[model samples]
Target: MVYTKNKNKNLIGDKVKYARLKNKPKITQNDLLARLAVRGITLEKTAISKIESKTRPVTDKELVAIADALGVSILWLLGRE
Candidate 1:
């Protein structure tokens, strides 16, 4: 068995945080969690915080859900836009 550690835990963490805070109403961590839940992606408040803090790795499913919840594109979240 082999494992590779990514240089960065997640590429979209900062962007996710940015998009969330950049919202007109500034979505809080809890709000983001709720949004994700509405999208059928359940995550804890701490998980959201970790994601935003770049300390957690987001799954592809989570990436899509988060992007949708934040009303942003995956490309944008990946810093491609």
Candidate 2:
């Protein structure tokens, strides 16, 4: 049995995008990339855009960095909390 977690249909990208953009001070993808850089994660703005558009899959490490950069919990990013 090969089980996949959050598989292809997960809304994590949308959630990350929302968390990055819908706050008190709306954060742009570039800003998010910069913040992630400070946290030792390197991601491009285009990648972030793809993530927001649901055209890319997010890895666990990337998800963690994104969650930390957005100041949201991983469970929240996964829509589990």
- Kindly report the root-mean-square deviation of model 2 from the true structure over all alpha carbons: 3.2
lDDT of 1 by residue, 18-62 (tens): 898889999999999998898889987699888877888999999
Please give the clash total of every predicted structure, in order. Answer: 0, 0
Best model per lDDT = 1
lDDT of 1 at 27: 94
lDDT tens digits by residue: candidate 2, 1-81: 677675454468888878987887999888998988998888765988888777788888888898999989999988899
Candidate 2 lDDT for residue 60 = 81
Q: Model 1 Cα displacement at 75 (Å)? A: 0.3
- Flag regions of model 1 displaced more than 4 Å: 1-7
Show pairs that collide, candidate 2. Answer: none
lDDT score for residue 16 of model 2:
83
What's the lDDT for candidate 1? Answer: 0.89
